[model samples]
Target: MDIIDNLNAVKRGKLSRRAFNRSLLAAGVGLFSAPLLPRKALAAEGDHPTFFTWGGFDIGELYQPYEAANGALPNFSIFGGTEEALTKMRGGFVVDAAHPCNVGLKRWVDSGLFQPVDTSRLANWGDVMPELVAMQGNDNGAGSPWMVPFDWGGTSITYRTDIFELEGEESWDMLWDERYAGRLGSLASGGDAWWCGAIKAGVDFKDIATDMAFEKIAAELRAQRPLIRVYTDDTTTLEQALASGEMAAAMTWNSSAVLLQSEEVPVKFAKPKEGQLTWVCGIMIHKDAPNLEKTYEMIDAMLSVETGKFMINDYGYGHSNLKAFDEFDEDTLKSLGLSKNPAAILDEGHFMIPQSQDWESRMNETFELVKAGF
Candidate 1:
């Protein structure tokens, strides 16, 4: 389908925002080439708080409350990945609020570029999940969190069930199988690949910073390098590869399997025997926010049940609001690989631990070299 057809499908709920975005990229269309809202309704760009977030999240659906309160959505700046977002912010490209996941919580906080979110200003704070709020490095030492948890989900194998021959119960070894050497794919980001490597290498995340863990993980990645057909952060590439049977299996997030399933792709989001990498991502206000009050509103909107429902239903992600689960039955939640009690899924998965900046730099550098076949 063409980009216009894909976009119309998104508006009609026949396609997901992420899938539509992938279609746009495939058609060489920039995400911002068309405005999401009518030009007349939008406030002046500078009048609204800037929300720097991932591409799919810049949509107006997540900002309903913010729009209702201010008659316009927050200005948006899209980033391909969290690392890119952080690097841009560190370079003095400021936004009122930025989206970041739990693994980077400590490093982002230590950057001294963000401030703790005040829960009192958020109307939906009471309905927010305590387990998410209690994630490592979220506390601000004053009964508030550094980041207000938004979406949570797993990162694991999204393999073509029809093409991949399962020799045993699903395991992380699926990605390393020599039988599929030239047809496997993986995410390039060390934030994800390195953590998954630790799982595959039997290196405990608690000790991931240790020299032993680094060596083990690096060796595991290097061993798997030749097996990977591609290592990219773009979900579209992986999805397209899987759809065409060019790839047998790939590491992907929850939405990938969900999107593939919608298109009748015989795929499964694997619950590996070792474990899947899990994460919680949320919004953090900049310390020098230009529109401080609206920033709070933007965060509040994200935390609302309306936004939560969309996130849970459309994106197949677990929303931080407890009530968001009320909209789905147990079977429905199970199909999405989520549970009403999020701890059921989160606790069993290998939740990423916060790491020091030095450790992050070292891991990325080492992983890059390994990807280079060194």
Candidate 2:
């Protein structure tokens, strides 16, 4: 099928997103795996700017102001992971803006594919978290910001509360528990799973890619292989598996729990004793983007309080805007496993740090081997 046909298939639910992504992966196109919202509004053919992002962010709500001004939501193409998106962009796929996490900020910026963002243009700049604004590589060598920190969340165990019995505070060990073997699931990307294994193996995050750390983390993951029934970047699949008792427990992000619970599935998002694996993903403008003004409008809209509220409450991810926290009471935040203060939560979690390209290549290759029973 053609590109438009494929997109139409996914939009209509006639195709499983994972299957479509796998086909794209086979064709050297990237897959988008993040939470996908059902289409809220579809614009006329080519009426909207294109946003290359994780699957679910194509919703019109986050870009309301942009749509209000331009008369349509941006067209979206999705990728399953940051690395996949980066690879596609490097291979010449262009969009107005792309979403990438801090772990990838430096590499994406250094590739010279993105232009720096002028903070002055973002009306919500003052309300953005300072730490995220100052994240490494967020600054161009010339001092302008290269990325706009947008959404934040943690990677941890999301288990069926009705199925799994806890012995103590929730832990990553629950994933490796023999009792749940064949019923456990995990994300496929080493970007997440390897770090999660590091936490379970007791490796310091700072030493995560070191030889000693790699050995320990590898051993832990090797042991975990047989326990996992599936390894995929498809959050929707994982959520369904958990709800249907196909997965008693799984390594998933906070959104999975929120989405599942919203559907009335009895689930719990755990604050693992070792700590949750945390990340902040944001938007970067393409250096050659055609719709520069509209892109800025879209970026600013995403940073607004309206978008922030949807991100935090509906999606269970933290918003970059501090004012977004005011929309939720402390009790509600706690119930969703979030802190009103993003910094405290970030400091407590095993936040992903920037790594060398060499390290990333090694980890990806090694993890694939480990998954293949090496």
Instruction: Please provide TM-scores, in order, for all candidate models, with all chains considered together.
Output: 0.91, 0.87
lDDT of each: 0.86, 0.83
Best by lDDT: 1
lDDT comparing candidate 2 with the true structure: 0.83
What is the Cα-based lDDT of residue 274 in candidate 1? 92
- lDDT (Cα, tens digit) per residue for candidate 2, span 22-51: 455446443344534455554423635678
Candidate 1 clashes between residue pairs 3 or more apart in a chain or in different chains: none
lDDT of 1 by residue, 161-259 (tens): 999999989999999999999999999899889999999999988999999998999999999999999999888788878877889999989988877
Q: How does candidate 1 score on lDDT?
A: 0.86
Candidate 2, run of 10 with poorest lDDT:
28-37
Deviation in Å, model 2, residue 178 alpha carbon: 0.9
- Itemize residue pairs with steric clashes in candidate 2: 31-79, 31-80, 32-79, 32-80, 33-80, 35-56, 36-56
Candidate 2 stretches greater than 4 Å from native: 1-48
Count of steric clashes across candidates, in order:
0, 7
